[model samples]
Target: MHDDMKNTTPDSHKKKRIVIGVSALLVAILAAGGAVAIYQHSASAQLAEAKSTCAQAADRLRVAQNKYSALINGDEYKSAVAVTDKQVEDGRVVTTLAKDSGDETPTMVACNVEDKTALERNTGLIDKNTTWYETHAKTIDADVKNVVKARDAKTLKDTQTALGRKITDAKKLYDASKDKVKDDKTRDALKKQMDAAGKLKDGKDVKKIKDAQAGLEKAMKTVNDSVKAKQDADKKAAEEKARQEAEAQAAAAAAQAQAQQQYVAPQQSYTPTYTVPQQSYTPAYTAPAAPQQSAPQYSAPAAPAQPATPSTPSTGGNTGSGPISGGHGCGSLCTSAPTDTYVR
Candidate 1:
């Protein structure tokens, strides 16, 4: 009985060893199968995530492309877009590799991050430019409208030149007529107007230029009127002076003709008359007694003396009347007589 027990115990020990070896083998197989299943699930999830990441990145790229299209086509912005396009292409290559290989590499992740960052930067630039343009749109439109108006109406330069010419002509006329202007106040007023016109500038407003032109024209007209009035006045004054001088000359001529009508001369021819007195004296018979006693009584008997006769004075005339007187015994025989003679 002791020998049979020993042999049975050895066999039982051998069976326990075999059973333990089989259980260990089955456990190892189950653990390996579970590990494979876990690995496959994890791999599928990573590929799905990679595909999602790639799709999101592609959407972002499409959005960036749309933004780039909307931005202003400038040299600087286009160059920046070109650089971003290269990054997007790199990201696409990484995404395709990740999707096909069902693997996510650090390199692919980095490419996606870089692509997104570049798209964000490009979009920011586009938004900045859009905001700036939008803010100043009204101001730019106003400027453009003004420029167009100026161009249509005779450009600002041409308008300025025409205005300058008008001013120059007005100045010349003013200078020519200033000396003839008689009124100081009017001349000064016109001068002030001209100065204002001269100072006109081609500013932004068209109304101001038109106003200046009108003012200059009015001033020129005023100057011309003043000059014409002065000339007329001078002409009238000259005519008046000439008429006065002619009247004075005619009066002097008439006075000289009236002084030749009064003259006088001396006369030479005269006759004179004279008168004699009406008295006579005579002697008696003294001559008869002297002859009777001639020889005997010649010495005794002397003849009586005769009486004296009066004489008459002659008058200073062509004919004279007077009485003649005689001496001794011829007093009575003398008679008064008148004398006549021609005087030349």
Candidate 2:
């Protein structure tokens, strides 16, 4: 029994050791294969992640390019041109941040390259380009802001100057028109509008200033209308006065003409009237003279009928149509010679 026990234990122990050794070798081989697979998967994943990141950066750069394109079309570009000889200077802030010397465009690195080192290098370049785009955008944005601010300030100043001039003109018009306006209220309203415009002169709100200008102009219109109405009324009154004076003068002239005509005396022709005077004479008888010169018995013609004394002219007597011949002063009226019928 002792011999059988020693022989049987040796074989079994040696087989057992061999089997354990084989199992350990198989486990080691399996572990080595799993480690290789894991390493390969990790490497591929890293490359894919890098590609994705690089593509995203490229996309971001495209977006930036679009934004920059739009930005340059804005007013900042115009101001840059105007201030810098019609083009952006190379040394300017935004211009300096443009594409690098080797880069054809401002675009970032692409993800097409598969080498890890190249991908990493491209990633760095993408980051740099991103910074450049951001900086350029920011610089241009600031320039735009400053330009717009300056332009607005200038516009405000010009508007204020114009408004001030308008206010002055309005004031002058008010001074001249205050008393002549038909209504006191219109002139007062104009003054109020001018004052309001003056208050708004320092403001930056263009709309409000323009509104004030409109108000002032409207108020001026009212004042002007009132003044024109008064002027028209005064002109009409003056014309009426002139017409009245002319009519009065004409009437006076007509009255003077009528009085002159009425006061004129009628011319009259005078007719001479003669009145006969009756006289009685006493007869003187003389003794006949015995001795006389022989042939001429000429007695002095009876002392010609003594000339009839002139009597006062009769105002009521009618003038005879025919002329009368009388003893005295009958030469012009008598057609026959005197007859000597009785001698003294």
Candidate 3:
């Protein structure tokens, strides 16, 4: 019986050793599985935390990008273009505030992606944009302020130049209107306005300069109207004087012509008018019965006394007709009247 017990002891020891080895193998497998499960849980938590942080950053970035775009595309930015010259004069420059300062551009992503690599990349882009906008926000606002200042400066300068020209022109008009206006008051008003215009150069205010220009133009209009009125009156008076002088000249000419006609008539009717007709009548009367027209024509100056002289020359005591003698032919119509009456 002792020898049999000794033979089974080795087999028992071997069996116990095999059982301990199997238990150790099972414990190792269970520990490995627990480690893997813990690792997966920790990794998932990390990814969720990263996603939350990235999404919050994305929200901030979106707000920043909206602000940037509004500033760059706003009316202030557009108005800056018109004030280029003024900006240069004032030593102000406007440039791009940010590379992403454009239309409503959102962030790269909202961090809603599941892939780790994608989340990292999009988060980086959003962070970069947000940082850029934050860094230049003040500078962008400053640029807008500068543009406004430049616009005001340009307006002031242009107004000054235009108003200065008007002042100069008004002064010229005032000078010209010195002694030509109908009333001295009109020139006085122009002078007052011109004097006020000179003060415009000293002031920087646009409203003051514009007001001066308006006043000067109004005064100039008054002066011009007054001068025109005076000129018209002078012209009308001159025309009236000229018309009166012309009428007087015409009347004098008519009177002179009438006097000339009266004097000429008196000269024409002196004594020759009656004497000439009688001379012609005497010659014609004796020409019908006797051929003594030549003797009558020659004796026409003494025709009134020729009849008695010819009758006395006849030898007969009663004389019916005159004798035809070579010395005195056709005695009644002889060339000369007898000096004595029929000498014995």
Tell me, by TM-score, which candidate is best. Answer: 3
Q: Report the C-alpha lDDT of model 2 over 253-300, residue by residue, as the tens digit.
A: 999999877665321211111111111111211224233422222432
Give, for candidate 1, the lowest lDDT window spanning 10 residues.
335-344
lDDT of 3 by residue, 1-344 (tens): 88977787787989989999998989999899989999989888878877877888888887887887787678976676445543444543444322223324334556878866777777788898798776565566776676677667767787778877877887787778777889889888878887888878557887888888888888888889999999999999999999999999999999999999999998889779888989999987846636434544544545444555553454455454543334444555342343222111
Summing lDDT over every window of 10 consecutive residues in candidate 3, give the lowest-scoring window.
335-344
lDDT (Cα) of model 3: 0.72
Candidate 1 collision pairs = none
* Residue-by-residue lDDT tens digits, candidate 1, 1-344: 99977668777989999999999999999899999999989866765565555555555544544453344244533333233212332333333322332322121122233344454444454444444444333333343333334343444555566677887887787677757975556666667776776676556455676678777778777777778788889988999899888888878766665543221111111111111111211123444444453443333223322212225434553232222333333332222111111110
What is the lDDT for 158 in model 1? 56
Q: Look at candidate 2 and give me any clashing residue pairs.
A: none
Estimate every model's Cα lDDT from 0 to 1: 0.52, 0.69, 0.72
Q: Which candidate has the top score in lDDT?
A: 3
